[model samples]
Target: MLHILGLTANFSLTLQHKDQDILNVMSLVESTKRELQKLRDDGWDSLMAKVASFCKKHNVEMLIMEENFVDLRNPRKRTNISNMHHYKVNCFCTVLDFQIQEFKDRFTEVTTDLLICMAALSPIDSFHGFDKDKPVRLAKLYPDDFSYGELLSLEQQLDIYIDNIRRDERFKSVENLGDFSCLMVKTQKHLAHPLVYKFLKLVLILPVATASVERCFSAIKLVKTAARNRIGDQFLSDCMVCFIEKELFDSISNEKVIKKFQMMNERRVVL
Candidate 1:
């Protein structure tokens, strides 16, 4: 468990980063999956050494791993398994196998490819992350969004788009994708590269990074506690939105709120 937790700590840190883009997040996911699999394959001896060191430091008695493992509560049931097998196979390998399977299940090949293709839309380092082929492939992923003709047009547009954006002084100051997107609109580049802009918008909308979703889920715990379990979905959603965007709501005056509510329906009393 300790070794597994240590390995997963990197993933936790990556997920927690506020400025993480889809490109990096997707890369992290693939790297983490590889690390976990590598650990599962060749990490038994190292993990056991760490466990032994901890047990020694704490004065915990080491088990005779070669002896048969017996359940004290169920002595009648004769199970033939050594302590080594029980700990190494039943515990360590089992946990590692489960984690490996989870990574595989969550990040299937198709999903990973989709995310990688989306990463081509990242606008970091003066559009250094841009890939013309990948975005064209990304457009292929969603046939409904990009018809056959548009796909062809997207390839041509990407050629001009990259050239134009790279030369434009206004886009040099753009940092993240959000800023790049805003600058594109401000300079009317989005209109010039409509297909590329559409792909950019698609990348922006994908929930590739977990921070925002995790934040909302954490807020849900506070907003919908046991005491407030009966709150309807609509009301709960409203409460969550208010709680999540408190800064935005705080800027609105109470008088404006009252007037907004006053307009919702006819009331006998006026405030």
Candidate 2:
């Protein structure tokens, strides 16, 4: 039971998508299937049989009976076995099957499209596995942002953009969408691959984990405690943004903030 619990925890960690690619997800799934198959083939029944034989040979069963190690009477009175090893083995198999089925249901091929699109934005290996079609399909999903002509132009733009970024030493080490976006901004190449950028932006904002939403709620609770419960919605929103994106907020110069604030009002205090 403890072994199964450990496997469950490890499997959950594999599903976590922090800085992960589509290939990584697929690899984890394949590895999990292998582990589960091994578990099933090695069957808990065999382990139970060995354990029971060991206890019986050592007369440990007599000791257990005397010490009341197990409840001999079933509450339901459905079985006559002294030990419930068979039922426990069946229960373990059932749980393992359920976990496998749940994993398959949650990560079917249809759900991989977004992941493939996100993987195309990878900056490593010269973006060798980058798929233009995936991002194009992603753009088609947002018809408002991409017309047929725009998509064709985007394809051409992506070819150029990929070539440009590949040769540029500045982008060689970028590992995530956030850093890639900053690099684009720094190099002023955002307009070059507009559709790709849009798709990348969508990928960047997609919830990698529910914990991020939970974190936002945690921030709200902290920022809107009893003392500040009456804060206006706009102010609350601003506070949340600042709290959630503290790194970005920290990057802004106080001079730039003061200048913006001064521009917002006719009168301003000297800093």
Candidate 3:
């Protein structure tokens, strides 16, 4: 179990990479799914051998695979299953299957499609990730933002946009979506390709820095408690911002806060 779990743990760490582009992240996810499936099909024998070696080295008793299984929780209880069934099917196979299903469940067809579409907008590799169809599909996902006529316009713009961006020297060195968006605005490309820029804005809204968003939501739960259910919107917003950005807020001196507060109102007793 540890051996199987250790493999998935490494995959988990790989997914946590801060600098990985969305395209690479999706590829890693797909590769992990295949790897886990392959491991399930052919890893049992190798896993068993490793377990046996560890048992022998530690002077641990080893059970025969063919022997009738005994339940450790209830020794008096009789079971018809073999030790191999209990260890392999009940433990190893179960764990692997659950992880495989989890990967499948997490990256469903819609989510995968969305990521692929989003990847098309990635500026890494000199706009090599650009796909005309995927970005159209991405725009289609947001029907409210893109009308039927706008979709057709977007396709035409995409043709010109890719050609323009690839040849343009300004965007040649741009890497990642954040830098791409900033550079696009810097060069006023957003004005030239309004629809594509809108799509880029939508993509930028997605939580690329996932840890910060998660921390913000967790901070909200703590700040907006039952006692503070009636907290005003502006006050809640300020409190939540301070709570989430503790380090930044911590650097703010109390004297500075008092001075700022004093400036906000004409206090008769001025400090």
Number of the top-ranking candidate, with TM-score as the measure: 3
lDDT of 3 by residue, 48-164 (tens): 888899999999999989999999999889899999999889988898899899989988888888888888887888877678999898889888999999999999999999999
Task: State in Å the error of residue 189, model 2.
Answer: 0.9
Estimate every model's Cα lDDT from 0 to 1. 0.84, 0.72, 0.85
RMSD of each: 4.6, 6.9, 3.5
lDDT of 1 at 84: 89
In candidate 1, which residue pairs get closer than 3 Å at backbone N, Cα or C atoms, i.e. clash?
A: none
Kindly indicate the candidate among 1 and 3 with the higher lDDT: 3
Predictions ranked by TM-score, top down? Answer: 3, 1, 2
Q: By lDDT, is 2 or 3 better?
A: 3
Lowest-sum lDDT 10-residue window in model 1: 205-214
lDDT of 2 by residue, 216-267 (tens): 8889889999999799999999989999998888999999998887888788
lDDT tens readout by residue for model 1, 1-271: 7668888898878878767666677778878878888887898889778879989999999888899998889978876999889888998789989998888898888888888887776666777878889888878988999999999999999999998988888877777778888888988988888888898888788765468678988899999999998999999999999998988999999999999999999999986
**TM-scores, each model vs. reference:** 0.79, 0.65, 0.80
Highest lDDT against the true fold, candidate: 3
